[model samples]
Target: MVKVATFFAMSVGAFAFWQTMDKIHVWIALHQDEKQERMEKEAEIRRMRAELIRENKKRESLA
Candidate 1:
């Protein structure tokens, strides 16, 4: 009886651990995707700002 109870408890614990790990992996993946998107947006903004500065300099030189 004790052996059966112990086995059952261990089984439950292992299952819980597996589920928790799965959720953590999913969260990490989502976080990484968000980070990548943010980086891309920032790069685009920087490029736009650089272009605007170049255009303003051209206009000033012409004037």
Candidate 2:
């Protein structure tokens, strides 16, 4: 019947939508982790720069 075929198509479409949503969620989570790691690396670089500046200042004071 036409009604039964329509129902089957809708079900398949819903399943495909669910699968796509799951993949999107996984991709978003992966990108979020990468962003966090990049932020942490930037913070470490800033900290190292500050430390070097302090050491240079101390050496200049001694001279």
Clashes (N, CA, C under 3 Å) per candidate: 0, 0
TM-score of 2: 0.92
TM-score per model over all chains: 0.93, 0.92
Estimate every model's Cα lDDT from 0 to 1.
1.00, 1.00
Tell me the spans in candidate 1 whose CA falls farther than 4 Å from its real position.
Answer: none
Tens-digit lDDT track of model 1 for 10-61: 9999999999999999999999999999999999999999999999999999
Candidate 1 residue-wise lDDT at 9: 100
Candidate 2 overall Cα lDDT vs. reference?
1.00
TM-score leader = 1
